[model samples]
Target: SSLTPRPTGGISPIALPVLESLFTGNLQEARKLVFSQMLVSGQAAENGGSNNFIIGKRNQRALQVLSKSVDQDNCKTNALLYGGMHCKDLHRRLESMGYVAKKTEWRTAWSVD
Candidate 1:
């Protein structure tokens, strides 16, 4: 099915339910929800609609969390794994925060011919 733009549903559908599960200490349920919603989100990005906008919002939220971890938690090291499409924007954001890439490695999750 071609993904239809549901402007009202950028990420909340997945995030909220997954978050709820996590908050309830249901790690297994949260994991399941993430995979299930990932499929839907992947379809949407592959097929249609404002994918960039959605991805941008997700990246922004992720960075906010990362920032808190660094600033408030005094984290000396952290790892962020996100879709490759988000790298450019994330790199810019990290650089703006005076972060420089120390190393980069690519491990193929899958590839299709």
Candidate 2:
């Protein structure tokens, strides 16, 4: 038998700023944040050689699961835990599906003083 780990969500940590900007009514800032982070990640999405295909696949699967779960009458709340780079797009998809963000609670994933 073998154990394998599958991607369950986006893995970028920079989504914090993008999300913050979005929640604060700054769509331009959020787009800039996501685009800059994309460049920094070397995903050069504007070029055809970019490797976001994998990410797109993972996000699609995750969204499918989220949508199905949300449609369940017994399911009341859900969380799409993904990294910051992936958050902006995922947020848009969720919004298109009629999900409204009620609030945000941030916890420090790490810190140094």
Candidate 3:
């Protein structure tokens, strides 16, 4: 009998400087940082919600900066997550700005799952 293959989810490392610029309210720098980070992150296309919360939050900030920057349209998370490339671009921009740097030491996991 042939074994069925499971689809593997793709993971990419987040960029730091882009995130910093966004959180710092540097839109021009944030744009450059986001574009560069997208290139480096190694995903062929932008996958939505790879960084949703950060993007959504920062987007709110960007809106405050340029009141007409984004449309008044709204959608739920499910729609946003699978929306498409535009959504991905939006997400990437937000993620870069809002990402926090942290240091962590990992220990063995004891899973209750």
Candidate with top TM-score is 1
Q: Please, what's the RMSD in Å of model 1? A: 13.8
Instruction: Summarize candidate 2's per-residue lDDT along 42-75 as a digit string, tens digits.
Output: 6444323344555666778999987788776557
Whole-model Cα lDDT of every candidate shown, in order: 0.76, 0.66, 0.47
After superposing candidate 1 on the true structure, give the runs of residues whose Cα lies further than 4 Å from its correct spot: 1-49
Better of 1 and 2 by TM-score: 1
- Rank the candidate models, highest TM-score first: 1, 2, 3
TM-score of 2: 0.49
Span of ten consecutive residues with least summed lDDT in model 3: 75-84
Best by lDDT: 1
TM-score, structure 1 vs. true: 0.53
Taking all chains together, each candidate's TM-score versus the true structure is 0.53, 0.49, 0.23
lDDT of 2 at 26: 87
- Candidate number with the higher TM-score (2 or 3): 2
Cα lDDT of model 3 overall?
Answer: 0.47
Per-candidate clashes, comma-separated? 0, 1, 2
What overall lDDT, based on C-alpha atoms, would model 2 receive against the true structure? 0.66
